[model samples]
Each structure stands twice: as structure tokens, then as C-alpha cells.
Target: MKQQSGFTLIKVMLMSTMASVVVIGALKETVIQERLTGNFQKDMNARLLAEKGIFTAANNLQKIVSDNSSFSVDDLVNQHGLHVGNGEIGDDTVYKARLSKSAEGLLEITSLGQRYYGDANQQLVARFELKPADIKSPFQHAVTGCKGVNLSGSGVVDSYDSSKGPYSETNRDSSGHVNTVIGDSSVTITGNSPIKGDVKASGVIYLKGSSPIIGDVHSNTGVEISGGGGTSYRVEGNVYSGGFFTHRGGEVKGYVRAVGNVEMKWGSKIINANNDPYDIMYGGTGNFPASYHAQESVQLDDGTTRQNVSYSDAYFRKTPEIEPVKVYDPSSPDYDPAKPNKECDPFELPLNMPDVMEQNPERDQDFAVGATQTYMFTPKIGRLMTSQVGIKKAVALDSKKAEIYLFDNLSQSHGISDTTEERVFGMKNFKVYSDGKMTITGGDVIFLVDGDFVLDGNAKLTIKSGSSLTVFTTGKVILGASGQVITEKEGMTSSGIPSLNFFSSYSGRDGFQVKGASDMYATIYAPLTQVKLSGSGQLYGTVRGSIIDSSGGSGVHFDSALKDVNFGSGGGSDEKSQLIFKGWFFEPAKPLPDLETDEGETSNSDSGSTDD
Candidate 1:
């Protein structure tokens, strides 16, 4: 009986031991499953964080490319990498990003994401391609007024394609558009002059007298047309006004659209291109009244009367921003006033006076006072500096290439053939009394004038064929009565107009003036000054300024070839080029070293991945 009881006790102990082993195995399996699920969740979160890092890095790169034209994607590879944000997200998740250039010459952005607590990590790479952005030419119009424009007298505003030939009636087109960008400014066209192009203004546009606008007229504020003296004032193209449209004694040969009221006075009519009466469309809810004289009615082509109409499609566009002028920076390492490819910005001159004086100290001399002095120049004497040059007698320049810097004003009086008169005037108090026939020949020449430039009384500045002249001034420029700037020679098939260029940095009113019967064949760029064309002076190339005032019988002719000219690298906005996203990919998750410390805590530092 004792042996049997002992056997029962042994069997019970063995069963109890087996039950304990099964329960321990089941608990161990449950713990392993939970740990697997937790690790899977951590891996997904790290991957999502890596994607966020890639997108953020790409966004930053795009902005940098858009804001700076000189910025290149290669700069990123040189700098190794750029950090994205603070690199830390909530719940102990962190990310790191770097931009580099791939072997295919494309931009590649790499990102690493990690969760320190679980020791999970992810990596991704994105690629991008570079493309040129859409850029517009700065000189898209005949005359661009940064402030305002005034077209008075009988001066005609017209256009001609110099790429085709010189100005002729058959070679002309209606592309001579004039505009004023200032919202408070206006474009005033008065007298009997005819504008053979479109007129656009941000504010009001005033058209007075018997002048005719051959193309469309668009004004953001209002349009006023008034005529008298039995003259037929006309606008041959469509008229669009954001405000009221008033016609006193003129004719509109096309449709008229206004956001405000439309008024037509006696003898004023609206017609189509075929001279048939057309309806006026207005969007204003106010009353629009029309008045006519006794023998005149609103007659249509079918001999029927027509009435004005209303429209819901009448809309006004926001004014476009004007293109700013670009100037040179002296502090730049690539600063070269003679080179046209240098980068520049606004309010800075291309040439620095101090640098010029320092480089050509031996070339400094006073103005010579004698009989016609002839100066020959080679590469050794390519640069010269003078103070206040007054040309009385004839002065001849023969050069291969040269640059002349004038510290003060340059004045030229009437020419005199008598040497005795020159000597006598020289003996007297520095008063010039000789002919000012300054002739330039041989090669290209540039002049930098610090003060005013006055050419008057038969002062002739002749630029011979095969040679060009460029003038840069900081003061007023005046071509007075009987003054002539002859660029075109007899029997030349092509015009010499492109060879002469005038650039003024003056910021005052009437900074550039052309008086009397002088004819100018040059392009003028004076963004901060006022360009005035008085008397019968005719300008043949494009002109850009703060204000353009033409109050003479002669006109302005824009050369279409000037549109293809490139001034330099920097101007207006910096969005000249950009990059485009191509594709992206995920890299294999690199094994992260266990960061668990002895205190049963995870380390914050991610030392597994290195920046490249």
C-alpha cells in the first residue's frame, strides 16, 4: 500500500509540471506576436516620415532655383547636404535629408527617417530635371513710360521693321504701342498728330484735337475724346474703358466697351470696320444718354437706326507691372563695364568712376584748345579721361577701339574755318567760337559723360560707316537748333541706326532733349529720366524712360530689330529658369544598430546613417 501511494504522488507531480510548460509556451507566443505587430507599425511610420522629408527638401530647392538666376543645382553637391526643418517630429520620430547630383547629371534628393524607440528606419531618393522658364523681352513696346506719357503737337507715333529696311510708307505697321504703367498717371495725346498704333494706359487716356488713333485704345480708368473746328477726330480700332467713355465730336470705327457710362455728343458716332453703325456695350447700371444734331442719326448699313446695348462680359484687367532697369555692380568679381554679359541690378551704373580713373591714370588730360586737333588711337591708347570738353573747332578721332571718360560737361558750338578766330577766342575768356564738327572713324568707341552734353549751332557729330558709338551719361543731354547726329551715309543699303546707343542715368525731368530739326537714329534707354522731343526732331529707334513727351511735328519710329537685342543677364524678375520633378524611388531599409542602453532606455542619437 505504501509503494502504490508513492507512485500516485509521482504521477501528480509530473502532470502538474507538463501543465506549467504548456501555459508558459502559450504566453511566450503571444508576446512574440505583439512585438512583431509593434515593429511593423514603427516601420510604416518611419517610411512616411522619410517621404515627408523628401517633399520638404524638394520644395525648398524649387524656391531657391526660382528666386536666384545664378543659383545652380551643382551647388548642392558641392555643399554636401542641406538640413530640412528642425529634423525632429513628435513621438520621437526624426528625419534627415540631403541634395546631391546623380551620375546622370540630374538632381537627386535623399532622405533618412528613424524612430529611436523601436530602432526602425527608412530611406528614399527623388530625382528632378532642369528646364528653362518662360521669359519675355523687356523692350516689347515702342515707348514705355514708367510714370506717364504726353504726345502733343503734330508728331506722328509710328513703327517700322528695321529688319526689313529703313522707314517707308509701305514698310510700316501698326505695332507702335505706347503705355503708361503708373496707376495714377495718364497718357495725353493732343493736337493734330496721328498715332498709328495702340494706346494703353493704367489711368485715364485723353485724346484731343483732330488726331486719329489707328489701332485700339485701352484705359483702366476712362477715355476722353474731344474735337472741334470741323475736323473729324477718329479712333479706327476698338475702344475699351474701365470707366466712362466720352466722345464729343469724333468717330469710333469699331466696337466700344465700357465698365461705366458711355456718352456720345453731337457728330460723334460708333461704327464697325465697314463704316456701319455699331452698338456700344456698357456694364454700368447708371443711365447712358446720347445726343445728336439735326441732320445726323445713328444709321446702320441697312438704313435703320440702332441703339446702344448692355453686356455682362465687360471686365477690366489688372495693370501689368513695369520692367525695372538693370545696372552693374562694382563689387562683383566679374565686373566689367565693357563686357555686355555681366550681371547687374537696378540703380547701379555699369561703369564705376573710381575704377576707371584708377585703371587709366595716365590717360587723364585737360581739354585741348587749338586748331582742329586729330587724335589717333591704338590698343595701347584705348582709354582716355578728360575734364569738360568744349569743341569749337573740328576734332577728328581715329581709333581701332576706344573708351573716353569725360569728368565734366561736353559743349559744342558752331564751327568756324578761321584759325585766327579760334586763336582769338582762345585768348579771350574760354568762349568757343568755331565749328563743332566732331568726326569719329575707324572702329567702335564708347563715351562716358559725367555732366550735361549740349550740341548746338551747326554742331555736327558724324559717325562714319563701319564704326559705332555708345554714350553713357549721368546728366542732361540736349541737341539744340541746327545740331545734327549723322549716322546714315549716302548709298548705304542698310541703315546705321543700330550702331548708336544712348544710355542716361539721370533721374530729373527733361534729362534728354532733342530740339530744332535734328534727326536722331539711335536707341535711348533712360528709365529714371524724362525724354523730351521738341521742335521737329525725329527719333528712329526705340526709347524707354520714366516719361516720354513729344511736342513737335516730327515723330518717333520704332525699329523692330531692337527687340532681339539682349542687354545683360539680370533684369526685372529672377524667375528666368527652374527645375521640374521627374520621379522618385525607395531605397532598401538599412539595418539600424540596437540603440538600447543598460538602463532599459533607447538612445536618441542616430549613428547608423552618414550624410553624403
Candidate 2:
């Protein structure tokens, strides 16, 4: 038995070694497979969570905007999901925000999001960047929040606290071109290399060399280029023309939406311009194309700053309309706290909500719409269409989830569940609707529309500081016609009429939609801008960046106008509150030809005329 069992020691050792190698290989393969599967699942979950967070943030922002007609990151955070929580769509997983601006006025946002794994115990993280679609945004050069030198040129970025007075240049970089960026603190761009981002704030943005931009440029303000550059070059953002913006002798080859008082600079070889100085957009074109927007009365200050004087107004046009009398009770104190806010503008369409909130017998059973059609409420009014035309019904949703459109705040329990349903939302909460006869019936809807809005005879409209809006005809605001708009907000310095700095954003869909009775009366009690009228639509209100191009049609009818308003120093006169003409203050005619410079100009030789 001993002899049979006894294998040599060397043979036994060799067999053991072979077995160990096989076990290690098999174990490694299994671990690798598990890891791969885990990674894939983690990525999928992260993407879903990120999308959810974005939707949630957008919804909350809408709510803020609808109320004041404006919103910001702070407002969003206050309204939406928490930055940290258990849900997959927590703030850490998703966030809508604004990053710090460079000296050029570009905003950049950066963040990391965590994803949920199949098991409650597993999660992963992903880094991301959100770039805004405007010129001069810091995101292009990786200049975020308050870090780095975001100015145009390259060198040590000079730091100058505006609060501390005049800025001084300390460190000098004599190496090359001195197109340095003025930053928040100590930063620099070696003019040798094209700074990573767009040239911010100052309308004058330029590149010393022929290098094109790597990221989009944002001129939410405007842009000015020296050295003869024009429309043949690449610009990722909108190009605002304040003055004669010639590049370094090149052409612009991208999108440029100019909205200012007048053409800043004259045309050059870079862009084909007609002799008419104001005809900047149609520089070389002989005729003014209907599609071209000739900003006649616009003022392009410095390159980044501008204003469309002709149109400026703000308003909420809160649904459950109002013809503001005196803001008293809850939504502006009123005789009947339960009655709809009389101060709300009528023309401002109400956001669609659950009919349950209104006990009207004629309203739709519920505010639900299929993907095929816009939410139609047949409450005496005809079919209404909102920009948010394509929204799916909650009940009809395939996954039992209500397809919230233009809404925010999905996690904090604001959905229309089968049982615990309450108020639903519209686009980012910015717009809501119910296609029914808009007869004021219910506890007044008191959402705020930020800006200075003008209400015609739907006089219940109330505008406050910096906000501007124009009420058109058609709908009637809730408040009775007081003929006076309440012009005040909670945190305004002096009780002045609407201005620009008040809101982070604004709204004015259609500006005004006046019908037979819905006309803009006047706001003697409050300050106002110029009101223009001519055709079908009335001036309900206006946003900061808007142009009233009613020139092709009839002039907008304005029964009244504002008075003695100072827009700025050495600029243009503010006719009453109308910085620009009430109507379309633009040059619509085609530019005359430049035949004189070309060989096309010649005398007839057959009849003894000079043909030289």
C-alpha cells in the first residue's frame, strides 16, 4: 500500500504548482467579467439620473420665471430638488447653474454627478461641463466661476477690484502682443497663444493672429473686432454689432443676431455693406432683404453693451387676469382674497393647470393632452396653442408617469398622480394653459411675471423696478381697470418704473395681443415706456432683448406715453419712457447700389457718349 501511494516528492510538487496556476487564471477571468458588467450598469444609471436632474431643474426655473418672468440659479436651487439627498435625482446628481464670468462676461459651469447602481449600495461619479451658447462665455477657455484670467490678451492677468476704483497694470509681459485679459485676480494669457475662451464684456473682441476660436463665443452683450475681421470668420456665439465691427481684414462665417438701436460701424471690405450707414447687416447686398434685421435705433456701446430703445416693458400677465386696482391682500391685498387677482393682465395667457383648482362646470374635466395635439380646453374660447404644444397626458403615459412639459420640481411631490394629484406644470412653469373661455372663475392665480410690463386698458397690470412688459389687446387682467399700474417691488432702492438690472431673465411672448376691447390704456400713477399701435396686436409688455418690427404692417397704437426718462449719458434721447420710437425704428428699405465703384458704370459709345 505504501509503495503504491508513494509518488516521488518532485512529481507531487510539480502537480500542485500546475493546479494553483489554473485556479488563479479562472478567478481573474471571473473578476474581470463582473467589473465590466458593473461599469456598464453604472454608466447607464448615471446618464438617466443626469437627464432627470436637468428636467427637474428646468421645471423649478420655469416656476420662478412664470411668477417674476425671470429666474436665476439661486431661485432654481430654492425651488427644486436638494443638492444632497437619497433620491437618484438629488442636487449632487444634477444641477442647473451659472458659473462666474470672465472679464468678457461669459458664464461657465462645471460639476460632478453620481450615478445609482442596480443595488442601493453601489454608485459612481462623472464629471461634466455645461457651455452656454453665447459669445465671450468663459467655459470655452476653462475659466469657471472665479478662477483664472478670462480676459482677451495673454500675459499676467491684472487684478483690479471695481469696488476699489481705477485698475492698474503691475506685472508687464514684454514678450509679444499686449492683448492681455483683465481678470478678477492674478492671471495671464501669453498673447502668443489665443486665449482659450471668448473675449468677454467689452464688445471689442479680437485675435491678433489668424487663429479661430476653439469654443463658442457669447456676446449676450455684443462684440467689436479690430484689425479688419468680418462675417467670413468663425464665431460660435451671437455677434452684436454696436459699432463698425471690422475684423483683421477677414470675413465672418457664422451666426450673428444684432439687436441694438443703430448700426455701430460702417461697412468695409470684410463685409459687403451698402452706402447707407445704418445698413450694417446688408453691407454688400444691393437690396435690403426682408429677412435681414436692420437695427436702426439700436445703440451699440463699447461692443458688449446695447439697447433697443423702441421696445422695453415688463409684466407677468398672470392668468386668472387682473386689472390692478390696489395691491392689498395675499397676492396683492384685495377686497376679496378669494376673488381672482384683479391686478393680473388679461392678455397674459394663464398656464394650463388641473381643472380641479377651478370649479367651473365648463372647464375641461382635467388638463391633460395627448402627444398628437395641444392641450385644448373648450371653455368658450377657441382652440389655443402654446409654445409647449407637444405634451403627453399623464394617464396615457406608457410608464404611468405624467410627461411634464416646461415644468420643474418633479421630486418634491408636485406631480398629478392617479390618486394624489394636485396642480400640474407647463413649460419650465414659464407657461401654462387651459383652452377654455377665460372667464375669471376661482381663487385668483397670483404668479409673478418679473419685469416692467405695460398693460393697455387691461389696466390691472402691475409693473415694478427694472422689469418691463407691454400688454397687448384681447385678454383682460383680473383687477378692475384702475388706469394706474402699481410700480414697486420688495427690494428696489428708489420707487422708479421698470428698468433692466432687475431680472436675470424675462418674458414677452407676442409683446402684446390686443383685440377689440383689450387695449393698452395708460399708467399715469406709475412710470412707463413709449407705447406704439397700428394693427391687430396690442402691446401687453416687452423683454430686455426685443425688437418691435411692425413696420411691414400697421403702426402699433399707443394711447399714452411715458415722460422724462434718462437712459444714459451722451447717448440718445428717451422720448418719454420710449428710449426708441414706439413702433419699428428700423430701416426696412433695400440699400442703394454701389455701381459707381465697379466697371458696370460706363457711358454709351454708339451715340458719341464717353465710353472710357
Candidate 3:
């Protein structure tokens, strides 16, 4: 507008430069904001995919309630949008769907999905709450992934016969045999001695006898067992029983697991090896052996239909994660160096040993020839009951050789008593290797031991229930039973080693000892009172005591959360994966009918725990 004056070259250049700078800055800001928005959109979509999949599954489950049809993970993936093949983020991968119990009387169907990059991975999870809303009027939802398999009412057999081929609903021992048409099927039991064959029913199964069981029993829908009356019952499969497996007075063989709760009725005992001599069911997977009682009592979910049921204020979940490591012997070819290339053999003496090493007749070829000093006890064929480890005041160990050492270390026993101390064996010596399998059988034995002994390999040892074994600081002598009739020699001792010390009434006056066990991974299966964990190992049983201790064994550790434990101090001690003790902190044991305790505890005489 000023008309006529031509702009200067310098001004023109400056204006252009400023304009370019401003424009570039604005462009950069816009680009950054756009990128952020796009990322947010992508994240939102993925989240919706996960959540929406769950919602879709919930809606699809309409058919399951209507039909009660058994469903699997594949069915859920295909029918529901959970495993949507058209997922934008790589090929969609879905994990298996498993059914578990919910707080309410419902089933929880869930799935785990994941996507993997070079080193980074993302996991997506979805869950559906399934409740049998209408047991009768089963209807399916519009959701594709949802389906149903109808299972309701009592399971019964119209007629059963093991002898005449078809156990027709004719004349049979009607004592506990229920001959009725449950739901839409007829049920019958043959031979009368408590239905002892393969059974597939829609409803309840009412069989009689004193724990009447011969072979493995399986049920597809559900099973409700009253008293065993002493009959033995073995169930290899899961008891999806709408009711709990209650045994007022019955014993179960094999494993009696359920989709619900595992509990016992009135006066019952769930012992690893005791009482029932001939009652046991075998033939299954894993190292679990035969003749071990598997049933004391188990309840279904809370809402499960049952005649009568009892509940514990606390949940006793005893999980025994056993690392069955063998005792390594370097003398043999199967030697693995603790530290790579550290060639040291314990079983075989060094060639540099003085002439005195070879001439000892008692320790001749048999001891020196094979994998000896630095040997590991590899697992052979054996089965160990992980549920409950029996403890006692007195313990017994079988000698690997004619003469073995004994210590004051804890072992798998019943428990210890107060009035009997000097009459028992105290842990003192060191070189006692029962190969990790120490059986305490003598009556009311006592011990005072030192140091923590680790049991190598899958050592199988049984201990008396009511005996006691203690550990010592300078560890006392490895004393045996009365007049040392038990004949437990002293364990091998190292120059310097730490130990555990206890002189309480349970362990007694003479105290307990830590027997000499070099390549030992000893598992003390008992109602643990006080423990001093050393070395890197695990405790596989229950500890019903005032306090749980993890004082020593820097690298040595163990976990004793197998039995539902209580922590008075609400504390936790974990060193890597070696030791984890879920103790019954000041909590008393559940009052079981078959297993009772002394009144002195409640009355405050021999009361309180180590923590106090």
C-alpha cells in the first residue's frame, strides 16, 4: 500500500528465514502429537479386544447353563470372539481354558493370550463367570464362544452286576446300594458289596460298607459319598460332585480330589502310612506309590449340596515343591563339578593321601572303589506322600553301613515328648548317611542335634508321629534309645559347622543333635516348632509351632508351606527358591477327630512359641 518503494534484499531474506523457522517448528509439534494419538488408539483397541472377548464369552455361555454340555478351550475360542483370527496385532495366540471354582457357587472359565516380539512379550487375559442359573431350563446365549453341557440331579445305577456280566436290577444287597433312576438314567449295583466297578451317572451315588472300595472309581458329572463305613474308595478322576466327598467314618484309597473343597467328616484321620493296612489304591501317574491312604475327607464348593458340612476359618494349603536331587559321587563317572572344572571327588580319597588311607580293613575296596565322598544320591523308583510329613520327639535311622553316625538334626517323625530326654538319642556326630532316608520307629525317642542336614535325592524315610529331635549349637552326642538299644552310631563331623539348639519340653533335657550327614538332604516331616534353615533346600511338610525360624544357612533354604500354615507374626522369609516356610504362627492345629492333642496347650503349661 505504501506504493512504489522496492523491498530491500536484506529484509526479504530475513522475513523468509523467520517464516521457514516458524513453519518447521509447528510441523514438528504436529507430527509429535499425531504420533501420540495414533499410539493411544492402538493401545485402546488392544485393551478392548481383551475385555470385549471376555464379555462376548460371558454372553455366549448361555448354552452351557441350558445344556450342561462339557466344553473345552477350543470350543470357547472358536465360538466366541476370544480367538479372533482377524486380530490386527500379529497372529492371535490363545492359551487353554480351564475351569476353576469361584467364591460363589459358579465356575470360572478363563483364557490367557499372548503376543511375542524379539525380547518383549505382551499377555492378554480374559475370564467369564459361569453359574448354573437355571439347572432345568438350559438355554444358550447368542455369543458364539459359549456352549453348555447339562449335568444335574443325583447319580444312580438302576442295576449292576460284576459276576453275571450285566448287573441287572435284580436281587442285590440293598444295604447301601441305591437302585434308582437318577435324572433320565437307570442305575444298579451288582454283588452288593458297595458298588465297586466303573460308574457313570448323572446324579448321586449311594454305596455302602466300611470303606468299601476295590478299584479306581470315576464319575463324569459328580459324586457324593457318605460314610466309608470302613470301605476303601479310590478315585483316579476328578469328582465334579455337586456335593462334597464326605466320609463320616470311611477311608479313601488313591487320591480323592475334587473341583471343590477337600475336607473330612466327624472322626477321620488322613495319614500317609498308618492304620489301614490293606486299604490302598495304586496304578496312576508319577512316583506316587501304592497302599498309601488318600482319603480323609474333602468337601465341594461352598454351595455344594451335602447332608452336613464343616468349614475351617483358615485355609490349610500345604504345597510341597520337592527338588529330588541325588547325592553326587565324584569317584564314579557320573560326577558333575559344583563349579565347572573343579575336579574334586569326595567318595574317593586323593592319590596324595598318606599310606594310612588304604590300609584300613573296615574301609576297604567297597567304600573306596565306587562313587563315595563326593557322591550324589540319585533318585531311584520311589513314591513320597507330600501332603503330611509325620514328626516325633524320638527318631530312628537305618544305617547305610553297619556303623552310621547320628546327629541332633530334625527328621521326618511324629513329635517329641517332655518326660523322656536322657533316654533318647541326641544329635552329636556327623557322618551318618541313610542316603537321606531316615526312619524313626522307636517309641517316644528323643534327640539333641546340631546343624541343618539336607537330604539329597528322593529319600524315602518314615518317622514316628509323637517323637522329638532337636539341633544343638556345639551339637550334643548322637545318642540313641534306652541303653542305646537303637544302636545309632555317631555321624561324621566337620571341623567347623553351625547348628540348631533346643532344650524345651518337647525336645527334652539331653537336647537334640545334628547327626553327621555330609551329602544329606534330610527332610524333617513333622509338626515343626522351631527350624534353622541352612543350605539351599526346601522343607516339604507342616510346621505347627509358635514361631518359624530361618536363622542360618545363608545359601541353604527350604519352604514348608505344604500344609496350610498360620503365621503368628505374619512374616515371610525367602532366599531364592530354596526355603519358604508357611508356618502356623501361634495358630493351633485343626481339631481332627482321629488326631488329638494334649490339653496342656490350652491350659498354658507347655505353652507359647519360640517367637515369643
Candidate 4:
């Protein structure tokens, strides 16, 4: 029996010790792996902190850029460093960021996030770039409508650079090929019309009669061309249609591309503007350029580019041809409501309105009126100051002095001396609200109407040279049949027009109506209302609204200078400015687990070998 126990006690003890070593090593490795995972998670949190820092820096940079017109992106790279605190976490977590100019005028922002006394083990990094948003004009096109645009009768839609000499439609630019008319629904060009610029339609385009277009045509739906008998429909630019294209008569000087079939009628001509027939494409789809909707390149009088013309042709051409534009949806990340497109986005109201002093003691004097000699508010009496009130006896507003009128809500309640200078009365900047009909003949004035603006009895709001009239209305803007919002200044450019801004944010059925034989020279912005142009004369300025309606002969002449005009005093201290977002990326730090503290502490210690 003693011989049977061949295995000694020492051997048994050694085997037990080896097994204990293996188990201890396995537990240690498991703790190390778990510690590594915890460290990795901590690194991710640090990276998020870095990303937050980048966001803070970007917003601050935008504010700085918006405030300082003279500062360039390069200046930020050289002079700016931002330190941001993480409020979500403890105070130990902080981020430092630096901004610099990257390639292609982009702003590069680099942020370093650290925690626990900024230790190297608890740090992360992130980087992103910013691009300035482009500044666009709502008046870049001759006509931009959300419903449909119909050019009937002998109506002519043309383009002329107001930056040139006197404004004339005949002032053509050979290289300036901007879109003349844009309709979200359909476009009908009939009668003997001529469009000197391109045309775009989200639905369909009907080209009948003898209308000739000097530029291209694009349609997301289809294009139907019919010259009829003895009529010639000619198009000088390339034509693109997303759907079927049918040409019955007339000639296309440029190439034609369509996503559907291209049908040609008898005796139809396909002439080439560049001697290339291959430019004609059919049964294929293509994208529209980004600037296809609002790009204006004009030849100025001195042959110098406007300061707002900072964008290159390629910048706008970068849009995909397959899908150049999309129906604006607020929920879409691609859509930016702040970007102003006459065909798409609605206009945003400015914060500050024009300042017109109602009571300036230095210039307040009572003028003689009909032997009654009642007190008439006058900031500075002009040359044609008179007491007669009718349109025939309307005072000419073209005087050298700044004429002022007070339409105070408290004009009767409080005496002039007893009235506190509230906005309802008058401040140094804003004039009091007009409760009743206000009349003006001629003078530089700021008219503020809190209620309906009515030009009764064929009244003429004549604006002449050296005269600047700014009209702010909260209600309907009604112009009578004979009422004329005319600007009569020789050699006057787009600046001759009055600055008319409708600050109505309400969705009510408020509208702007210009009727009769009168002509209007004003930049009309009524994004929440409809704009209707009737009567005989033309409207020579930009018109933006929820819907635009014009009589067949009510010609609309878009002023090119509106691209840079400051409708509100809020911006445009420097003409060319836009806030863009460019390269955005988040980089996370790699996990480097520390063996010291990340592991779980264990108090139980047991030797595998029992004591002898």
C-alpha cells in the first residue's frame, strides 16, 4: 500500500502552484481589458468636449466676421485664440481652440479638449472648417414667381445692368447670360415677346407666337414650342427639359437637352450657336447649376465689377445638373431659410426701421395753410411747400430740406410740450405712426404708417432728384388709378427709386396694389403678401412677395444694383459679405489605457497551495 502512493507530496504541491499562477494571470488580464475599455470610453467623451469647443468657436467666429467688415479669414488665423469651458461636465474639463485660414478661403478651427488638470492622458482633439455663406439678391431676375409666369401680348422681359449708364433694356451684355424669368409652376411666353435672358420653369414651358429668347431655357417638366404659321419662335441659348420636349416651329440656336423624347415638327430648325450639333441631347437628364436661379453678371459703366460680384462663375456652376434646386422644406437639412432666393425662400424682415424725427425743435415751424394757420409739422420746409392738399396742388418733395410730418397716435391726447418722445410720438430715428391718409408731394422724407397706406384721389407721390423717401407700412399699400409713385430724376440710376419695405410678418391677406397710368420706381419687398401691378405704366424695380401678378403690359424692370443695396441698416457695411459653412469633421483621440487606476481593486488574496 505504501508503494502505491508513487506521487510524492512535493510533486502534488508543484502542480497546485502552477494551476494557481495560471488562474491569477487570467484574472489580471481580464481586469486589464476592462480598464482598457473604460479608458476608451473616456477618450470618446473627451472627443465630444473637443467638438463642443469647435462649435463655440465657430459661432463666435461668425459673429466676429459679421461685425468686422474689414477683417479677413487670414486675420483670424493670426490673431484669434478661444478658450471654452465645458458646462455640461465638471470644471476640470476645458477646451482650447485656434482658428486659421485654410485653403480656398475657408476657416480652419482646431480644438484641444483636456480634463483633470489638462493631463496628456486625458486630452482629445477636433477640427473643422467654415465657409462664408453667399450673398444673393432677390431682384437678380426680371421675373421670379412662385405660381406661374405668363408673358402674353407684346410684353418684353429684358435685362440691363443698372450699374451701367442710364437704365435701358437695349443695354445688352454678350457674356452676361442671367435667367430672366423663373417660375415654380409653369411659364408661358406668347405674343411677340423677347426675353433677353434665360428662362427656368419647375413645371412646363410653352413657347408660342413669335417670341425670341436671347438666352437658354430650362424646365424640370417639359418644354412645348409652337411658332404657328407665319410666326418664328427663336431661342438663342441651349434648352434643357427634364420631361418630353416638343418643337412645332421656330429655331433653336443653341443645343437642346431633354430627359424625355425630343419631338420636332415640320420645317423646324436646329441652328447651332457654337457650330456644334452634338450639343443637342434628348432622352437624358441633367442637373442645373447652383447659381442658375440667382446669378447676375453685368457690365458696369466703368467696366469694373460690383463689389457684391465676388462669386466666380464656377461657384454657382458647382450645383449638380441632375438636381439643381429643390422645393424648399424647412425640415430638410439642405435648405437654409436665411438664403434669399426669389423663387424659393421667403424674405426676412430687418430689426431696425428707418428713423424719422417727428419733432425737431430746430426745424419745427408752423406753415401758413388756408388762412387758418394751423400748426403743420415740418422738419425742414421744402421749395414747393404749400397748404393746398389735392394732388393738383401737391407740394413737390424734391426740395433741399428734409420734410417731416407727424402722425402721432397721441397727437390729440398729449400736447406737444407734454408728450414724451415715444415711438408712437416720435424719436430721433422712427417717426410716429400715421392713423389717417398722409400726403406728400416732393421732398426727402421717411413716412411711417402703422395702418393702411392709401394714395387717394389720384394722388401723386412724386420723388425727384436728391430726394429719398422711405415708406414703412404695416397694412395694405393702395395706389389709386391716377396715383403715381414716379421718380423723375435725369441721369438717375436705381437709387432714384424709393425704399419701400413691408414689415408685415402676419399671414393675413394684405397686398400691394399699383394701378392707373402711374409708374412706380421702388424696391418693393412684401414677402408675406401678394404684389399686383395693373394700369398702363411700368414698374422699374425689384418686386418680391408671396405671389406676383402683373397686367399684360405692366412691364417689370429689375434693378441690378439691388444686389448690393442695403434695404435695412443692419448689414452691408461692406458690400460683399456672406457666411458659409465648409469643412466639418470630428477627430477623436486614441485610447491609451493606464494600468494603475483603471483596474478593479480586489482585497481577497488566497494562495493555491494549502499550508502543510
Top candidate, metric TM-score: 1
For TM-score, candidate 1 versus 3, the one ahead is 1
Candidate 2, superposed: residue stretches over 4 Å from native: 1-16, 36-51, 72-85, 88-112, 115-612
Q: What is candidate 1's CA lDDT for residue 118? A: 36
Residue-wise lDDT of candidate 1 within 269-304, one digit each (tens)? 666555333246565542333332212235444566
Model 2 poorest ten-residue lDDT run: 603-612
Task: Please give, for residues 223-246, the per-residue lDDT of candidate 2 as tens digits.
Answer: 444343322443333344332233
Clashes of each: 7, 152, 161, 18
Q: Write model 3 residue lDDT over 1-612, tens digit each, in one string.
A: 677566587789999999999999999999999988765654444343333333333444554433422233333333432222123444432222223333542334343222232112122333334322211110000000001111111212112222222122234221111111123221222122332223333334443333243333333233445553433433222222332344344444444433333445554333323323212222112122132233333333464433212223111222222221112233557554432111111111112112322222222111110111122111111122122233211222321111111211112222334321123232333232232334343332333223222332333323333222332222222221110111121111121111111222122222222222221222221111222322322211111111222212211111111111111111112211111111111111121111122221111011111110
Better candidate by TM-score, 2 or 3? 2
Model 4 clash count equals 18
Model 2 error, position 464 (Å): 21
Each model's TM-score? 0.59, 0.22, 0.18, 0.53
Among all windows of 10 consecutive residues in model 1, the one with the lowest summed lDDT is 422-431
By lDDT, rank the candidates, best first.
1, 4, 3, 2
Estimate, for each residue in 95-154, the C-alpha lDDT of model 4 and write its tens digit. Answer: 555555556656666666565645422333333344433434445566665555666656
Cα error, residue 11 of model 4, in Å, equals 67
Q: What TM-score should be assigned to candidate 1?
A: 0.59
Off by over 4 Å in 3: 1-7, 69-84, 87-128, 133-612
lDDT of 4: 0.50
